[model samples]
Each structure stands twice: as structure tokens, then as C-alpha cells.
Target: MANYERKIPILDCGHEYTRRVLHGKWKIRILLYIAEGINRPSELERHIPQATRRVLDAQLAELFKHGIIAKTIFDESVKHVEYYLTDLGNSLMPIVAMMGKWGNTHIDKLRKAINTSTALA
Candidate 1:
């Protein structure tokens, strides 16, 4: 058995707060898809086919709670809802772009390491 010691950080730290907002697996992807104009829940689900509606909805709720995204319920007979990024959410786009850029730059090396580890196992 492996010894799993956990260390906790100060929750009030600004950087930690920011990380909490972007903590979920689907949250960042949801933000990017919204930035790309996939504003509806169904559209987001379609764009992120790997995530189920339940998972996406949970992430969306968290994002909405953190004010990173806003859900607008339309006044229609059929009732429509759309998501828009708040200013804070818009502010995350560049960071996301940079993250993607960094991943792209190092993907070959990262993949090689993962493949080697998998083969070793």
C-alpha cells in the first residue's frame, strides 16, 4: 500500500480561489466551448461528447455559482436557456489559450512519457 499523506493549502489565497473556480474537469472545456459560441447546454454537450449531460450540468452549475458563467432563461412559450460568460469568464480565455499553447508545444514529449510508462506496466 502507498502512504497517501494529504496537505491542505490556505483557501483564502487568491490563486487557490481561482483554481477552485476552474477545478472541475469539464469546467475549463465548458468555458472554452462557450467562448466559441456553443452557448446552449445541448450544444455544449454535443461539442463535448465525452461528457454526459449530468456531468456537464453539474460543471455548469458550479461555474454559474462562481459567477464565471451566467445562465439566461428566455421568456418564450417553449422556454429557452443560454449561457454567457461573465467578465471574469471572458478574462479566463487568454489563460486557456496559453494553456492550450503550452500543451501543444509539449504534447509529443508528454505522450512519449505516458506511452513509455504504459508499456513498462
Candidate 2:
């Protein structure tokens, strides 16, 4: 049995559910990479060198649990694993693209604010 659970249940709303599913730091990036055909775990690790393999695996598990991604394992001379986005995940690409566009559009202001906050921290 699980010993840990949220004290407050997640709100039964579309916005809240979406936020819960996409809450992890690396999840969005993982989704984007998988969509771009960087599906192997090792490949993802190479692409996101700042993220530890454990963290990436955890985020991948979360994505899988939420049905946003599917995993495939190939058994040959050597085992291989790959991840792919699900239909639900594919539907989110436009939203993700728009978010990226918005960030690029406001990069100057956003970068300044983020750097300021980091400096303060």
C-alpha cells in the first residue's frame, strides 16, 4: 500500500487535472523530445544533460501513468526501450507550440524576470 498521498484531493476540473498531469519540471520537455523522434531513454538523457537519469525516468513514468505516453520494449540481442506520445499527448502539441511561441515573443522580459528571481534566490 502507498504511504504517501496528497492531503487535499485534486480538484475535479479540466484546468486542475491538466496542471496535475503536466506538473513535473521535465515532463513538457520529455513530451516535446518524444514528439520530435528522440524516443530512446539514452537519447533523451543526451538531449537533456542537465536532468539526472533518475529524474527523467520518474517524469517518464508519470507521463506513462497519465496515459500521455506509451512505452515499447524490444527484446533482441540487447534490450531496447522507447517512448512515444499518445493521442492525448499529440493533442497537446499545439498548446505546447503556442506556449513556446509566446515565450519566444516575450523572451526579453521573461529572461530578465527569471534571471532576477534566480539572483534573488
Candidate 3:
């Protein structure tokens, strides 16, 4: 083995900002679900049944704060709220798709390794 030198890179780029936008555990998943045409909170809940509503709401709020998604309310006999991707959020679609592609491509191997590790522990 050879010694390796690692240097800290400056967090002065869009990379850091992107990381901040997608920081939460559920954020990326939420984005994916939204991109897949599930934009409402209740729909998101049904799509991701494992996540609690509170946690999903918190992530949705963060996404809104980051200007990635926007919430709209309807004026009618029954009030309704829905979220749609902003331009900034649309910009991330390609990146997110690429990530999903990579993950799906390697998921079997990754899952096997993860399961092996978990079993060992």
C-alpha cells in the first residue's frame, strides 16, 4: 500500500449548494417521486409508504425553501395543495435521473454487499 495525500477542497461552488439542497434523507426520493408525476402530499405518502407524513412534510418544506419546488393552492369548494418543480428543480432532473440510473444498475451488487455486511454485524 502507498501513502495517499488528501486535500480539502473549497466549498465555494454549486456542488456545495447542490449538496445542501439534497441534504435530507428523503429529499432526493421526494424529488424523484415528484418527477415521476406524483406531486401531491398524499400521493407522495402513498408512493413512499415507509416515510412518515411529518418527515415528508419537513423535507417538502426544505425543498420549497431552496426554491426547488413550489406549492400551489386551489380556490374551490374544497381546498387543495399541490407541489410542482421550479426551474431550478427541473434543472436537477437530469442529475437525479443519472443517479437513479447508476443506482439501479448496481443495486443488486450493492444490496448483496450491504446484506452481507449487515449479517456480519
Give the runs in model 2 whose Cα sits over 4 Å from its true position: 1-10
Best by lDDT: 2
Pairs that collide in candidate 2 are: none
**TM-score versus the correct structure, for each prediction:** 0.84, 0.88, 0.81
- Greater lDDT among 1 and 2 belongs to 2
lDDT (10s digit) by residue, model 3, range 33-104: 887889999999998898999999999999999999999999889887899999999999999989889989
lDDT of each: 0.90, 0.93, 0.92
Model 3 TM-score? 0.81
Number of the candidate with higher lDDT, 2 or 3: 2
| Cα lDDT tens digits for candidate 1, 3-121 | 97768655788888888988988888899889888899999888999999999999999999988999899989888789999998999889889989999999999999999999999
TM-score of 1: 0.84
Per-residue accuracy of model 2 over 1-121 as CA lDDT, tens digit each: 8799889986899988888889989888999999999999999999999999999999999999999999999998999999999999999889889989999999999999999999999
Best TM-score among the predictions, by candidate number: 2
- Residue 13 lDDT (model 3): 89
Candidate 1 segments whose C-alpha is farther than 4 A from its true place: 1-11, 117-121
